[model samples]
Target: MSTFGKHYRVTTYGESHGRSVGCIVDGCPPGLQLAEQDIQPQMTRRRPGQSALTTPRNEKDKVEIQSGTEFGVTLGSPIALRVLNEDQRPKDYGGGGENIDMFPRPSHADWTYLEKYGVKSSSGGGRSSARETIGRVAAGAIAEKYLKDAYGVEIVAYTNSVGPIELFPSTKEHPSPSTNPAFLDFLNKVTREEVDSFLPVRCPDEKVSQSMSDLIGEFRDREDSIGGTVTCVIRNCPAGLGEPCFDKLEATLGLAMMSLPATKGFEIGSGFGGTRIPGSTHNDAWIKTPAIAPGETKPNVKQPKLTTKTNHSGGIQGGISNGAHIYFNVAFKPPATIGQAQQTTGYDGTEGVLAAKGRHDPCVIPRAVPIVESMAAITVMDALMAQLSREAARDRLQQAGMTNPAMMTATGNGHA
Candidate 1:
C-alpha cells in the first residue's frame, strides 16, 4: 500500500542509500502550470544537512522530472519524478565494519521488517528510513500547487511541541473554541514562506524556537534523542471534501500521517483534549454567514449554506469537511539510530553491545514539519478530486434532464 489516494494516486519507489528515490503521480489534472522549480522548494526543505539540528548528511536532493510534462505544463499523464542519492554512506550503518545485520537497533523496524519480508536491508533500515519520505514530499508539492491554484488551499505545519516544551498560544490569541476567530485568522493567512521564515526549528515563536534548538543540541551532544509534535492547519478547503463509509477525510489523514516513518500518533481538531469538556460546551453551533471570496462580488445576504460559529470539530464533521479550518497534530518519535550503546540480543539471540553508527537527527520534528504538510496536501487534494468528479457527474445528469426527484427515485428503485 505504498500508493496513496484514489483520484490523485502517488506511488513511491527507491530507498535510503539506493541509487535514487522518487514517485510517479497519476491523475493530476491537465493544463496546469508545472515545472521542476515548483517541486524543488519542498525537496530542499525535506533534504538532510539543512541545519545543525538535523543529520549532517549533505545531499542536495535535486529533483528531475522524468516524464508527464511538455512545455512546462502537465499532460494529465503519470508524472515521474526522481532524485539521485549522491551522498549515500551505506557503510555508515555498519555495512562492512561491524555488520549491523547481526543485531537490530531498538525501536527501529529491523526486527519487524525481517519478520515480514524474511529478509531486510542491513544498511539504514532500507524502506523504513526517513529518506523514503522524499518521494512523498516531492509528489506533495505538485498536489499543493494544484490545490492552491484551484481552491486557494493553504497548508502550513510547524513544530508545536518539542519534548516537554510546548508552545501554547495565549487564550486571548486563540479566543474561544466555539468561534476560534484568532486561530482561524492565523491559519487562513499563514503561508509556507511565513512558516519557513522562522527557520532552524520552524516554531514561529522566536523564544520557543530557540529553546527547541538548544534542546536538540543537548540531545545530539548526549548521543541520545527526543520526540515532539508537529501541528498543521489546512485553510480554505471547500466544504464536503470527504468520502464516507471508510474514506473519511480524518481517517485518510490519520492513515497518511501514520504511514510516515517515526510517526507515533495523529489527532484532529480538539483531539484527545476535547474529551475533557462537556459535549454541550464542545459542540460547534451553526451560524449564518456570508461567503468570503476574494475579488468576487456577492450580495450582502446570508449564505444558503450555514457555517459553524465554533470549530471544535476541527473543520470536519462526521468524516466530512464543514468549510472551516482543518487543524491537527502529528507526533514523531526520536531517531532510532543514536550513538549511545545499549545491551541487546543479536540475530542469533546472543546478548551484545549495540552502538548505532550513522548520521541522524536528535529530534525529527524540524524535518518532519514539511513531511507533515506534504502528506496533508496529498490527502486533501485527492479527496477534493474525488468530490469534484462526483459533482461533475451530477451536473451532467442535471444537464441531461435526469435530475428530477421522481425520475431519480424511480431510477434508484429500479423502475427504469
Candidate 2:
C-alpha cells in the first residue's frame, strides 16, 4: 500500500521521472507551529548531488506546502507537500543504443515490478525509485515536529557500517553496541549537528567517516556500488506506546524500515548478538528510578517510576515502550543500477549483456541517514497517537464511574 500508519496516515505519490514527488500528511493535531523551513533541512539532507560520493542528479528538493495550514499553524487537516523533479533524465535509461530497456537490471525492481503489474516504466524503477522516499521524509519531518513539541522525542540516525568497515566493529569481547559502554555514551549524547559535522559519510567518527568516504569513492570510480547499515535512536519516548500482538512496536518498526527501498534487514536492541548470550546474561534487570533533587523536575514527561539497569530490550518490554532510549539498525543492499556490464535475460527471453545507465549513488548510507530517522519518527508518532487515544478513552470511563472494582484492587495492590 502507498499509505502507512493507522493514525498519522501518510500517502505518497508521483514517480521517479514524474512532474513532482510529495505526500499528504493526515490526522496531525491542530495549533502547532509549522512552515516550509521546518521540513526543508531533512529534505535537503536526503537530496542528491550533495557530494561526489552520491549521485550527480542535481535536485534542490525544495518543498511547497500546498494546503492544510493557516498562518503557520496546522488546521488539523491533511497537509499536502510537493517537491518538483527538476533534473529528470528519462532518456538516459532508454533510447539511442542503450539496451537497458530490454533487460531487467540485476537485483533491481525491474523484473518483479513488470512481473507484478505486466508493465514497467521505460525510464526508471517508477514507484520503486528512491525518489518515492521524498514523500516519506517530508511526512516524517512533520511527525517529528509534533513529537518534539509534545514529548521531547529526538530521532537521530547515522552510518554504522559501509561494506566491511564499521564504526564500532563487534569483537568476541563486545559482540554488540549494548555490550560497549562507549557506544552507549555516544547514543546518549550524539546530536544531529554532531552527525552532520561528519558529512558525506555521516559515520560521526572522524577517521571512520573518512574511511567510508574513501570506500565509496573507490566504488564510484569502479562504476560499482556498495551497501551499508544505519543505526537510529529514539530518545525521550514515553512508556506504553506500542500495541501488543500483531502491531508490536518492534514489529511495526520492522515493517516501516523494511518498506523503504533497498532495505534488506532490520534488527532492534541487542539484535542478533543477543542470541549468543544465555537468558540470564541477556535479560534487562529492573531497578529503582534515580532520585530527583528537590528543585529539579523529572527528566521527561511520563518518566517511568522504575527503570531498567540495562536496555537489552531496546526500550521495550512485552511489546510496550519502557521509557528508555530505543535504538535499531537497518541494512540496505547495494544499488542495482551500475555502469558495469552484466549477463542477464531480457524481456524477449534472449540472453545479452546489460550495462545500465543513470545517476546513482555508489553508497546510499549517507543520504539514507535522514530517511532512516524520518521513518522512525513516523512510526513513533503513529504509535504515540494511538496510545493517547486509548488513554483518553480509559480516563473518561474511570471518570464516569465505570471502573472495574477488581481492576481498581489490582492497581491498589501494585499488580497493574
Question: What Cα-based lDDT does every candidate model obtain?
Answer: 0.86, 0.92
Error of 2 at 322 (Å): 0.6
Q: Taking the tens digit of each residue's C-alpha lDDT, what string does model 2 give over 1-416?
A: 89999998999999999899999999999998999999999999999999999999999999999999999999999999999999999988888579988888999998999999999888887999999999999999999999988888999999999999999788898787787888889999999999999998999999999999999999999999999999999998999989998889999999999999999999899889878767897888989878777996454476677888988889988889998899999999999899999999998999999988789999889999999999999999999989999989988999999987667553565473
lDDT of 1 by residue, 1-416 (tens): 78999899999998798999999999999998999999999999988998988999999999999999999999999999999999998887775676476789999999999999998886887899999999999999999999888777778998988998877543542333334565556665677787788888888878888898899999999999999999899877788889997999999999999999999999888777676667896888899866568997432322337788778899899999987789998999888989999889998999998988788999999899989999999999899899889989988998988776665553465474
Clashes of each: 1, 0
Residue 134, model 2, lDDT: 99
TM-score of each: 0.92, 0.97
User: What global local distance difference test value does model 2 have?
Assistant: 0.92
Best by TM-score: 2
* Candidate 1 wrongly placed segments (more than 4 Å): 169-185, 291-304, 405-416
Residue pairs whose backbone atoms clash in candidate 1 = 178-310
For residue 73, model 1's alpha carbon misses the true position, in angstroms, by 1.0
